[model samples]
Target chain A: MNDKITTPQTIVLIITTLIGVWITTLPATLAEKSGPDSWLMVIIGGGISVLGAAIVTSTGRQFPEKTFIEYSVETLGVFGHLFNLGLIIYLVILTGMVVRIFGEVIKVFLLDRTPIEVIILTMLALCVYLTRHGIEPIARTAEVLLPILMLPVIIIYLMIILFNGDLSNFMPFLRLDFKEIIAGTKATVVSFLGFEVLLLFIPLMQNPHQSTYSSFVAILMVSILYLFVVVTVIAVLGIVETSLLIWPGISVLRMTETAGTVFPRMDVVILSLWSIAGFTTISPMLFASAFGISRILKAREFKSFIVPLVPVAYMIAMFPKDVLEARKAVEAVSNMGLFYIFVVPLLILTAHWIRRRVLNR
Target chain B: MKGKVFILTVLIGASIFFHGCWNMMDLEKKTFIMMMGIDALPEGQQDKIKVTLTMPVPRQLVGAEGGGGPRPETPQQILQSTGNTVYGTIRQITNRLSRQLYFEHMTAIVIGEEAAKGGLDRFLDVFQRNKDFLRMAKLYICEGKAEDVLKMETEMEPLVVTYINQIVHFNSSRSLRAINYSIGKVITELHETNGNSLVMRIRPEKKEAVVAGSAVIKNWKLVGWLSDRETRGILWMLKEINRISVETSIELQTPQKGLVVLDLVNFTNKTKAKIQDGMPVFYINMRGEARIVEKEERIIKKEENLERYEKPIEQAITKEINNALQKVQDEYRVDVVNFGEHLRKYHPDYWETVKEKWDLMFPHVKVVLNVDVKIRRQGIFK
Candidate 1:
């Protein structure tokens, strides 16, 4: 929590977390609603995200070296623990949710015969293993996968677009009509949901200078990438086909074929590569949850404990009826996640102001 | 050392458990697809769509005398299956294969004129629905039997479908007969309002695939085909006219430059639809650079050439553009290029009132085409 020195670079925190959190699933899910205009919605959601990031970053600077949970105490007093406890619980829930959704998708598409519990446990195990390695391991993993993941994504996007897509599908341009377009932004906004995690890591930053700018840039890239996916899925799959499917982005992966060639169903490779994204997303949540418990309980070997705790996440995942129920369960928690993203910042700022006024007296 | 050990373990583990084909086919077993042709069987005879899948035999399989009929080592194979529906025929074909039939390699899809006219929408759905199918596969409306185009041999390339796919895509890219469509587009048009689609037409050459014509689709099914010239007109209204040719003639002062083909550059084509006293008028503005590609007579000086060629090229392109507008508006009676859609989005409330009449209003709608084509760059020859 000593933020007075040894801060993480703006680019490192921003790109590291951005690359880590942006697993393929979010955009893939959003494709159902936004269709060809999903990317535009990504930009729209991204813009809203920057404002959220700014509010969070500004509040963090006021507290000097303390992280968000620590500042929640200075702000809300007795309520600070309540805030911390809720967020930590939510984070654990989030880790399980990511693991569950990813496991189900892989189960249905690639490993239909594999038991869902086994799939969830295996993925959860990987997340726990990485959490034990700490933030630096996650960051290094992102660094390694960044070029490997992004270069191909960019190359594939350009190649698919060049092949031939019905521009007309995009044409009933902004075709959702205005009311639907605005409504579409809600879920699309959720996919770009990770910058809220920045509140936890601000103190760890080597140099928090221009952190907002780095975060915004990352959001912009996500928006553009999401938009590209939206456009491709819509232009290639059309609106109806896009909406009928649950994982629209995965469908896009299935379509990476060059006409008159032997290669077909390239999505399998994309899913394989995306395994890293999925892992990174879940690791942060588990690590933060473990870190929060350690802080609360004063436990040693906290990271090691999280790995064994994968069974707990696996158990929680089974509570949901199925994929549909699981998504609904996560969405219900979104109100709480939003509180963490927005409300906590304002609460911290209020606490700081009150603490300053009381101390001056 | 621990990290190294883990890395090695995972690498070996992935190889053992996930190294290959979690969701796809290996090369040996796949029935590779090139061209899929669908035609309706006549009435009660509607039991077969002369399905043809063209494949290439590698050089290794060529001219082997020791091989008995259709040797196992043959580089390529063309398999045909006849069934009632496109999906049905594909299934029948897959039954004959050792592995799944791969549609990712499909280059062009041909619907015989009859198939399209008799409702080919059902056939298109299977391709659209299949996750394994390539949306980028070029679509065509064939003039005669679709099997003819599929079965044709290639004079230049080994595979007929590859040659044709290139021809259609390349020319479409070049801004020639504007009908390059993916299956993704087909699905979209079938769903939305004022929704329509276009497909390229392919035919059999001595041994290669030829760009034959284009087809216009209405309500998910192909309605009619358009001439190559007409398809070019369709492109102008749609994608930006980047590098299309416009023919013109300039009466040279020093020497007569007769009919010349001008190459368009730095072009911008904008379409606007507005309610003028409660009537929708489409105003098209085109501004671009034009250069003389070929001329009956040549003037050496660049300045003189620019001065003489400017006015006629502008006039000719205006005429060319107006020609496209007339046909797209009147003959087709459908906004395939989405000009009306452009206006509707930017002006929603206004469109809501008059949207119903767009089809009725479009045919007679007055089109004002303005072209200000400037000559910025000419070839090295000029």
Candidate 2:
């Protein structure tokens, strides 16, 4: 179904995809590595991701009417099929870990008695339903849910900064060691891994040439939001305490008390709204993976492949035995995702350049 | 059409089975704990510790008349159980009661002197790790058994928990004698300072509970206590003072002296550290503004400068600060004024050299104080 998505819809898709389960634990990871300089590391990481997104978008623009799966075959022949298989595997594993982490967090904070298997299956069922509708519907759903996901987050950040923020927690500014900061930049870049969805969505845009602008705006928005999250969490909890927490974002919200108001506890409200964010993030990745499968098999409708992939994702989500193991699994999958997002795009561009210039085809 | 009907039937059936019924519990099936106290059991007892939980009785709270034969004297129920661990003790208490013990609404947690002295590191994890416990609850160290503080009666408030919570909020904002330290704040401070910090102190009297002063903790164990005046001094050094009255006798003429009380309205302080002779020297500068809130005698003339009253107030503050410094530095030898954190934040390189032996070198470090006070207003007569 060659339904076109507008520039604004593309921006919304990329923004929601970039923010997933990673937002809750990002501050703790950065605090453990860079201390008060976590905000600076986020900026460095965002700058690098912006450059990587630029490369991916420009490559997609080379063949305006073709998706990544289509153009890779035209440029590298047999090698492109292998690369396409790598992309599908990365997306499937990424979706699995996202669903698993979301289930774990909900079980801890909201529902203690519900089985985690029930949580995973329910979320996967919803994702499958959304993926069966194809790209235009997924983009529309993100456009509708972006405000619901962001307004509470922004309000919570403001309340924490106004009530409990301590400015001295960021003291001895910029005294971080050079090597430690470089190491932290690597972790921060992994949190920015979901932007690679642009490789599949660029060809579906109404004007594919504007993909660069769409990618820049989306990454800028997500980066500013992440910076706010890290700064507010560290400012309220301090570096040492933030590092000790599993979810510093939720902990910061827990510390805020809006007494004499209608809502005495805002953490529960913010978390319920955050479930919408989790749904938006997971559906887009599932859609991209199923679409890739349909293209490889020469099928006209991607809907046929959507149901079978659900059980595969369910099995992967259940692979990790515990929270610690789940984190290790996510790290392994993210490293593989980095290869597809960064190295593969550059290789495809080089092959296309050689074919056009040297072979004079 | 048949496939759509079958899919809809499956969706409806799944929703009926997975609608969060597994975790649902009715309000009547749970009991809300208002406050909790932990005390170390007496020597030679079977259990190591005792936990006391206070829950309000709903029938007594609403003053319902029909169902009860005779109303209870108190509106709350206090239950105590002894066990080896906190969670185990809670579960043991649950075995006797029909309703589950809920901690989401708990207002305060009081730790007894003996338990605090033993070490708090073991007891803090249950509150931090559990989802039911609230992080905003005020934490207190009692002078005696925590059970006595929870058992104390109040004339104004119906429950001791509400009484203690109100006093803490009021004193922390209007007076320097007490500081409100939430469990979340204490956890952060304990982690940052290696368990060297101050927690607000509470003591149970014959008829009431008093919330004042503070208890000093070193390496996760209670070391000593700071009195109200000394606590004010530590508050001044930490810049935690909001508004307090300073009373001192000022020289009016040669033979006559009068007591003048100044209301401190504004305060600001700056601390700087430097290394000299292999030791760290700290210089603190304090500036404050005050108004004439009360006076015992007419000691001010219309033409007399208000600046004359500034010197006595400054000396009074400096004396209070010095007394506190003497007790914390020489006697207890603990750094509760956050001097160690200040050094770590402003001087990271120098901190790296002495960070290992900071506990040994803390008491030897020298501190210099400078106070600047301004009397901005006088009484109505002036």
Candidate 3:
């Protein structure tokens, strides 16, 4: 846990974690809720999340060598410890929900006959092993896998735009009211939820002060990627078609065909890359939860908590029976994550400001 | 601790091979469906729909390409069954087959006139819900039984489905006579409350099949059809033209005895929809460049002759567009060219009120067609 990561590795972590299962489903969900103005919603929602990431990063910079768990206690005393325990529970539940979603997605696309429990257990076990290696290994793994995961996505999107995209779907722009745009932005906000992992990792960066700028850069990258995906799906599938499709991102990729290629199925390539993204997401969350478990128990080493936390995550992930229920569970976890990422940090920063200024005066 | 780590490594390594082949199905054990067709059943039949599946016999396909001593009797197999639902009939047909049925390679789905007219809502449900069906597969509406078209042998291509798929693909780029609609787009059309789309029409002849024209599907039912020329008009309005030749005869006052033909070179259009007098009005602006591919008797290479040639070609395009628009507005009364979508995108408030009664109001909507043609090239002798 003591090994430090550079600013670039932190950015890669933020990008990969945010790009998980949401890439396949966000376009359809946004299209259904926001019409053709879904890309606008993405920019607005991403702007709001950038403010949150900046706040969380600045707060981490204030306490140089300590993570969120240690600094919260230092600032708020007993209530801070209570908040730390709540964050730990939230992280565990978030890991569970993410694993459940990964399992369900694999079931739908690749291994349909296998039991979902086996899939969830296998993924959780791998994540557990990664978490046991501590934060440095996770960050390095993300660094190595980010390019491999993103190249295919970029190539597929470029091929689609160059060959098959119909830009007429973006017609009648700005027809949506402010209220509908706000509601659609709420869906985009959920996709950006995974960036909150920065809270736990800020202290582990080689230059913690640079995290504020690097985190914003990471969030901007995610926003651009999401905007590209959403706009591409809309342009390729049209608004009505995108809304009707359950997985418009994958559908658009599948619609693309390279001339005279032996391997024609772009969806298969997308799924493989998506698997890497999902793995990055699950491993980081698992590591975050393990860190939280160690902090709650006042233990020195988080490595001890990684193995025991796997069963807990596996049990909670298996709670959702079907895909619909799994989604509902994820929505609940996302709402909880929103509080930890925004309100808790904002309250801590406000308290830190008051303690330094008003009380000293 | 070292023993524990070694044991963990061994367990992890062993688990990969344990489940490596749990759900793997070899290529040989599955019959790859290349084409599918659905037809309506007879009056007294227990089932409401008849489903047909086409697949190539692996051994015969290999032998034919190898140019072996003798070709097999049948290179393809057609299986049929009847059930109340597509899924049920599919299950019934699969019951007799030894290998499992796979549909990932299916290139086309043909629907009979009866099934299409009866409504394609149910037939599309199976493809929508099933993960095996590729939404990119081409859809066709046959004049009679869809199974007949699937069973017809073609000399051009080894498989009838491959031949049909290639024709639809190539024809779509070269001319407006044949149009192909993917299952995904068709399913998307079904989602729209008043959206309309077209399906290619295929008619099986004696040892041959003709693919031309288009069948119009509006509100998930077949309202009518458009001939090859009328289909061209639809394509012109939709701006889907790639490289189509338009032949028009001009009566030159210069005493030319024979008719002249002009081939359209670069065709493009821009349509605008707006609210005027509490009704939707569309202004279609079309621009095309043409060449005098054939001339009967005139050898006038002067600029005046080219100017005179442009008006008759514009009139020819206008006449075709008007005829196509008239049939859609007066006879069938559907906005297959996406006029409603244009209004919905441009004028949302007006679209909300008219969207409910769009079916009734579509026939009365005013459309003004303005076509301008420029003679770009003349023959070398001219």
Give the C-alpha lDDT of model 1. 0.66
Winner by TM-score between candidate 3 and candidate 2: 2
Candidate 1 chain A: worst-modelled 10 consecutive residues by lDDT: A1-10
- The segments of candidate 2 whose C-alpha lies over 4 angstroms from its true place after superposition are A257-263, B1-23, B45-47, B63-72, B239-256, B298-300, B379-382
What are the per-residue Cα lDDT tens digits for candidate 2 across B15-119? 998865666789999999999999998888634889999998777667666655564557678999999888899999998999988899997999999999999
TM-score, predicted candidate 1 vs. hidden true structure: 0.76
List DockQ, one per candidate, in order: 0.22, 0.66, 0.43
TM-score of each: 0.76, 0.94, 0.93
User: Whose lDDT is greatest here?
Assistant: 2
RMSD versus native structure for model 2: 3.7
Encode model 3's per-residue lDDT on A135-212: one tens digit a residue: 889889999999998887888787777666667677668888878887788788888887777778877889989998
> Model 2 clash pairs?
none
Fraction of native Cα-Cα interface contacts (under 8 Å, chains A and B) also present in model 2: 0.72
Q: Model 3: how many Å of interface RMSD?
A: 2.2
lDDT tens digits, residues A1-361, model 2?
A: 4678999999999998888888888999899988878999999989988988998999999988887899889898999999899899989988888999999998899888789999899999998988788889988999998988988888778777766677678876798788988877867888888878788878789999999999899889999999998988898889999999998888777755533134566789767866877888899899988888888877888898888999988899999999879988888888887787788889999999999999988
What CAPRI grade goes to candidate 3?
acceptable
